[model samples]
Structures are given as structure tokens and as C-alpha cells.
Target: MEFRRLIRGRVDEPQLERIGREIAKRYDRESVRISVLEADNWLSTPCVVDEEWFVKVISPQNALVQALFTGARNLGVFSRGEEGFFERFEDPLAMSQHELEATRRVREIGLNAPEPIEAFGVDEFGVLVLEYLPEFRTLDELPSTEVEALASELFSALTLMHANNLAHGDLRGENVLVHGGELYFIDATNVRKDGLSTARAYDIACAIATLEPALGANCTVDLAAEHYDAATLLAARDFLDLVRLRPDHEFEATRLKGEIERRAD
Candidate 1:
């Protein structure tokens, strides 16, 4: 296994080697493909080692990964480790086990989701092997009309997840993929198996909020109204407005709040 070593901390070379070996061994492939993906704000840039299955593996940035996933930040000095910066180092395998299970569950339920080929117990690799759909495009790349259509398609996936008592804690455009006129949901890191949880509302709100860039903030409200009842729409609007008010990005919150209030009237 060859490690590109584009960024030192990004890919765990040893783990990558092990993963590659395991993949080759399991599949009886003689040669393995390896490539590096640059890091981005949304996800830890993972290396694509197996082109055949599109294997994306993240080294255990453990607590840091968890914090980023949950949008939680703390002031602390950075300490280097295999997983990444961590206040207290956590085992990568232990941390990623739940996520792997959640992702597999999404597939088991027949949602248009990634097939979790290999998940937990991959030797501290924290690897999430997913079926690669190269044709899928993010919501940002789609036009307004397609964005609205994708929004409706997303609602169907959301319904399946919620009906099974699963809430994709992170509901953003980047997490939704569209291919061959079908919508597929990915990134199960934040899934919670509780339909009744407030997180479900958050998912709906986040979905609508994420579509605002392409669909327009006001337009998304109407789009969501097509599928959701009055109460749910109201709840989604409230949540979307609240997210806009976070300290760093509160400029739009007041306007959104006023809009929601006026709509209620």
C-alpha cells in the first residue's frame, strides 16, 4: 500500500495499508488503487484507496471528529495523535463503531443510501466503505427547479428514516446526493434511532435551511409546506430561523424570524 502523504495528519498510513490489505484479501484482488483527497471543511478529506468500491476512510481524529460532527467546539491546546487533535485521546475503533452501525442500518432499511461495505472493527481505520455513485451531484450544483424537486425527494428519504425511529442528525445539502433522478442520503455519522426526538425536527429544519441557497429562503418554506403539515412547517420554520441566529451568522435570523411571524398571521 502506497500512502500519498499529501497531508501528514490526514491519512493514517499504517491503517491505510491494513485496510488496503484487508480489502484486497477479502476481494481476492491482486492490485489495489490508492489516491488522496484534499481536506475540506465539511469532512475530513479521506483517501480513495479502492476505486473498485470507492473506499473512504478517515483516521481517528477521535474527539475532534466528534466535536466537528456535532458542531461542538472547545478552547484547548492541540495535541497530535493518530486520529488527530484531541483533548483526551479516544480509540478510533470505539468512537466510530456506532456510526458504522447506523450507516448499515440505513442500508438495511432499503433507503437510497450508501451500501456500508465495511464499517466497524476495521482496525482503528475508522473506515466507512460506501458504494460510489459518481453521477450524483450536490444540491448546490443543481438549478432552482431541480433543487425544489430534490427537496421533495429528500423528504421521502427523511420519512423512511424517521418512520424507523432514525433521525439523521445532520441534514444538509452536502449530505444529500442526487443521481439518475433519485435522491440518496449519506453521512450517517449523526443518526439517532429516535423518531420522537427533537432531533427529528432539527433534521427537517436543517433540510429546508440547506436548500435555501439554491431554492431561496422563502421559497424553501413553501416547498416544505407542500409535504409537511401546518404544525410541522411551523416547527421547521422556527428551527431554521433559530439556526440563522447563531452568534457567527445572526444577520439573517431577525429577518427570517419576522417572516415566520408574518406567515403565522
Candidate 2:
């Protein structure tokens, strides 16, 4: 937790005030209420604005952390005998711009994502604005039964993204928000087109890893099987352990691996 804080960093009150002012000016609001969310995210300082806009104040530190995570994920891909495919951003605004574009891409392909308002620079921070879902729960926050019920929808969304050649490089459970009874993806990282296949497999690995915790290894593998063939499952299986290394993920990778092998058989 401390390490996460170290990397995630904090936006001081003054910086938040500046961000709020910028947001207010951009939307022609006299003033906006800003409330920082208590989320276990490492990439941005997320907050709600005027109870309407879901905003991310991306700091240079957040961009650096993203670059580090991208590097590490690429190294993991290399372990699978492939070159790295994840792209790195040089600044905070670049990160914000990428997310804005990614969200638009997802929405363009008829998937759920927050309505992207805009991405702009405000001093040292890059701010991204989107429509806020006042009530929602992340995938990891749901009960086992509810999570199981959403299994098909979850995999289907992933399938749509992969089929459209849009790879969600980061598909962690937290990034999958259940809002108004629908799943909305967020925080999609940039990936190279040449690495799309590897990125797709890694996305599937994260999807399976995410479900196994809530639905258990057996059900999770079965759900994956319905959407993906045995070969793809085998490919995703190779990345399971690597996904497990992340601090946010807590699942029995060995059991998941066994289940995937059984499905392949």
C-alpha cells in the first residue's frame, strides 16, 4: 500500500483547486464541486466534478508510473518469446489524450465507456473529462453470484474489443465498472498495432484472472472457453502468471492454469 502511494502520489489541495478552476472555466461553470475518489488506482487522481463529470487529473508522476508498468508488461511479453507491444507516453497530457481517444474508439465500436468530453492541459497536469456514473461497482466489488451472472457479458465485451482490432491493454477488474447494470471499460492503455495479437491474449489472460477470483477457476475457464477456442485459451494461459504478479490481482494462478490445461485437453 505504501509503495502504491509512493508511485501513485497525491495531488495537493492547491493543485486540486487549480484543476477545479480549470474544469470550471472549460465547462462555463461558475464553480464545481470536486471530490477525490478513494480508488486503488495508480495512474491518475480521479475525482467527481459538480456531481456530473468524471475527471482524471493526470500528473507527470502518474505518466512515469504508467511507463514503468508498460515496460514491465512488455518484458513479460518478451518472456513469451515476443517483442514488447505496449506504447509509452512522454507526458501527462499524452496519457490523457490517449485515454480520451481510446474511450472514443470503444464507443465507436458500440461498446460501453464513459462519454469522453475532452482532454486538455492545465499547468503540469493533464485533465480528462467524462460523464460521471453516480452509482456503480467495480467487477471485484460484486458478489460471487452477480459476478457469475455477468460472465457472458464480460467475455462478450472483450470479444468485441478484440474483434475490432482494439486491444485493452489493461483489463483489470477495477477497470471494468458495472454501472446502471452495464459494464463500462476505462483506463485503456495504448498498444502497438503490430503487437495486437499478443496484446489480445494478454487481455484475455487478465479477463480470466479477473473472473477466476469471483467465479472460481472452473467457471472462469468455462466462460472463457465459450468465447475463445482452446488454442487461444492456451495462449492466454501463458500470460496468467505474469498478470498475477501485479499488486492489485489476487488469484490462484496455478489452479487457473490447471483449469486452462484441462479445457485445452
The weakest ten consecutive residues by lDDT in model 1 span 76-85
What lDDT would each prediction earn against the true structure?
0.58, 0.89
Instruction: Count clashing residue pairs per candidate.
Output: 2, 0
Candidate 2: segments with Cα more than 4 A from true spot? none
Candidate achieving the largest lDDT: 2
Between which residue pairs do clashes occur in model 1? 60-83, 61-83
Tens-digit lDDT track of model 2 for 1-265: 8988898998999999999888888879898899999987899999999889999999999999999998998898997798788888889999999999999999999989989999999898999999898788999999999898888998898888877778888888889999988899998655667888898899899998888888889999988898899999998989988999999888999999999998788
Instruction: Please report the TM-score between candidate 2 and the true structure.
Output: 0.97
Residue-level error in angstroms, candidate 2, position 124: 1.1
Q: Write the per-residue lDDT of candidate 1 for residues 1-265, one digit (tens) a residue.
A: 0222322246556666777787777779885776765433233445565655656565555435555534332121111111111122255554445555777778777877766666544665555666777666766568888887667777777777877767676566666778888877765543334324455566677776677667665766666667776676666555554455322122344444455556666
Q: What TM-score, over all chains together, does every model reach?
A: 0.75, 0.97
Shift of residue 175 alpha carbon in model 2, Å: 0.7
lDDT of 1: 0.58
